[model samples]
Target: MEVVRSKEFIADCSWGAKDLASMNGISTRLHWTKEPYKWHVNDGEEVFVVLDGKVEMFYRIGGAETSCILESGDIFYASVGTEHAAHPIGEARILVVEKEGSV
Candidate 1:
């Protein structure tokens, strides 16, 4: 058993993550980032939750690009084949749920 405080979560580097759990081939992770993640498409669906701070989420669909700002407690759902990236407003803690080994 373990307890993680998202507000106190910090990483040694940008976009560092701690694996929280894996169930039914789905992985849950806690991530700390102060920079933007690379644009990529996940092999499956992704559930992105902002636990602390803020984030600017960018996504491309049908070759059209769009973005949205997400505050703490906001959730972003990325379906399969969705290309996306996350840019933190400052230091942010995020929870990501997706298929195992997805990128």
Candidate 2:
């Protein structure tokens, strides 16, 4: 068993993550970021949870771009083939769950 303090966790660099678990080909991770992530699509669905700070999440659907601001405790679900990226308002801590080895 292990205890992870998400708010207090820090990464070595922007968008760096700490692996928390992997089971049945799915992986859970805690990420720290101070910048925007590149736009990309995951091989499978993704669950993004904001644990601290704020984030501006951008995505494209049917080739139409959209975005939303997510604060702590907000959750974003990205279905498969969803093209998305995250721009943190500042230093932010996020919990992400997705397929193992997925970008």
Which candidate should be chosen as best, given TM-score against the real structure?
2
TM-score of each: 0.97, 0.98
Clashes of each: 0, 0
Question: Model 2 TM-score?
Answer: 0.98
Clashing pairs in 1: none
Q: In candidate 2, what are the lDDT values of residues 18-99, reduced to their tens digit?
A: 9999999999999999999999999999999999999999999999999999999999999999999999998999999999
Off by over 4 Å in 2: none
lDDT of each: 0.96, 0.97
Index of the highest-lDDT prediction: 2
Model 1 alpha-carbon miss at residue 26, Å: 0.6
lDDT of 1 by residue, 12-59 (tens): 898899999999999999999999999999999999999999999999
